[model samples]
Target: MNPGASYQTELAQKLQCFFSDQQQGLDIPPAQLYRIEGFIEAGLLAGFITELGLKQTLVDSAKQYLNVEVADFYQQDYRLILHMRMHEAPVYPSSNPPCPQS
Candidate 1:
């Protein structure tokens, strides 16, 4: 599978499993699942985008949405550079025990 599609599928499956395990006795319907999935999907996209260093696309989109120039759009948020670079390291969530660090 393409990497992006694989990531999205994994994220959706995680959300499904989380809701399933949480709502064992209660009635969790498809609508609720979809809402929760929407939130999770948005978060996942933002996190992945940040990790993959898509600052220009993010900034350009923000500018279009907010009706501002690129410079003005970034004036108050210069740290997006650091965020998408230094602090955006990818994190793999694994259920298995971690291997010994050599």
Candidate 2:
């Protein structure tokens, strides 16, 4: 048996248990359930990281980055950070392109 098999099994159990608990407590409509289902992974990952004893600052920072889609959908600050990270320009660009330096 692979040495990491136990760890994998434990993680799977935790994911299932976490998902099940959320599924029970949530009260969303059936029509929206499929779409809402995808976001659960972000919460699950954050929970797993916390359970593994990662530092709170690191966990919060990583979760904020990882769930940027959710943040953008909800109009949160991470959307701006995500846009800045994605930009190819070294400096922030305005509506007009930067003028070449002499």
Candidate 3:
């Protein structure tokens, strides 16, 4: 697969596993649920979904499927940092010709 496709797949798998694990036995409040749902939706909009991955079908599917409500304690700043890391630009080696021999 292409590098972009591979990266997306890896991201989707990580997200799926993370959310699924979070859904184990947690009881989340409604307000926190809303925040969790928003975060998942943002991920979807940012192209984090796959054929069998997170989607916008219902109001609480993110909670039901990914269970991000567990992370509600994370502040906005922390979430932003995570988001930036996930979408960080790739670095490439400098292409300038090697300095001419003295």
Candidate 4:
């Protein structure tokens, strides 16, 4: 297994537990529970992304083409960089898609 995978999974689980405990202490109405859940899930996702350090890796790998040094790279918001990279990933069509034969 990848090292980052384990770290991300552990971090997400820990954050979820923390948020769950907070939810228990809150007296929010049923209608607001969904909002809390969404917030928790988003926090977990962002935390996971940060813990993975994929953005750092991407920056390190592109140092030459990007004309940026390691020290300078640290000055940027790598989390947002990773988010943009993920957003730009290709999306394949689902209908009649190619698949490996069983």
Candidate 5:
């Protein structure tokens, strides 16, 4: 499958997982579940980085550049950064266990 379809499938699966507690009486409709799942995934990813990462100044700077609220979507745009090796080197230093590819 193409990237778009794969993303959609992954998103759907995430929604189902996030809402597995159908019995919890959440103020969420199953139809709007994808939005919640996406939010959870983004929040969890950000929390992981903040809680376990290298705590580097550059990363904090990068997050600001991207706007903290949606920083989770800011993968190092190698094309935009130009400094290739410099960019990749941060990958190892940025997280304790390494950043996950979502």
Candidate 6:
């Protein structure tokens, strides 16, 4: 089989096994399961990386392009950098309070 097909099959099997194990004892609804699966798939595609690791890697590659040092760096390492930047950004509170619900 082609690499892409093989990867898809593997991913499917992993998702099946994961949901089956999760449902063994607990009562989880289908909608919840679907949502959880979406999160899992997203993480698999673009997941978190340790801040220390990312920093060290960047420091090591400061003089050169990261892609030159690591093949497919854009596919994974770049995402980590973006994730870190987004998460580390400062959040400011709104001046106005939220409207009270009836």
At residue 6, candidate 4 shows an lDDT of 73
Top-TM-score candidate index: 3
Tens digits of per-residue lDDT for model 5, 1-102: 965456545544543443333323334454555565454345446543232232232234335433453233224432211111111223344446766999
Candidate 2 lDDT over 1-102, as tens digits, reads 553455445544543443343334543344444433333334345453332232232234334544445334435332111111221325754798778999
Better of 1 and 4 by TM-score: 4
Cα error, residue 87 of model 3, in Å, equals 29
Task: Give Cα distance to truth, residue 15, candidate 4, Å.
Answer: 0.3
Top lDDT prediction, candidate number: 1
TM-score of each: 0.27, 0.26, 0.32, 0.28, 0.24, 0.27
Backbone clashes in model 5: 0
- Against the reference, the lDDT scores of all candidates come to 0.47, 0.38, 0.44, 0.44, 0.38, 0.43
Candidate 4 vs candidate 6, lDDT winner: 4
Give candidate 2's TM-score: 0.26
Candidate 1, position 45, lDDT: 65
Q: List the lowest-lDDT window of 10 residues for candidate 4.
A: 79-88
CA lDDT, candidate 1, residue 4: 63
- Winner on lDDT between 3 and 6 is 3
**Residue-wise C-alpha lDDT for candidate 1, range 2-95, written one tens digit per residue:** 6666755665465445333433433445665566546544655666434333345444443443335543545557544311111234688999
List ranges where model 1 is wrong by over 4 Å.
Answer: 25-102
Clashes of each: 0, 0, 0, 0, 0, 0
Over 4 Å off, model 2: 26-102
Could you tell me which 10 consecutive residues in candidate 2 have the lowest summed lDDT? Answer: 78-87
Residue 78 error, candidate 3, Å: 8.6
Angstrom error at residue 69, model 5: 28
Model 1 residue 12 CA deviation (Å) reads: 0.8
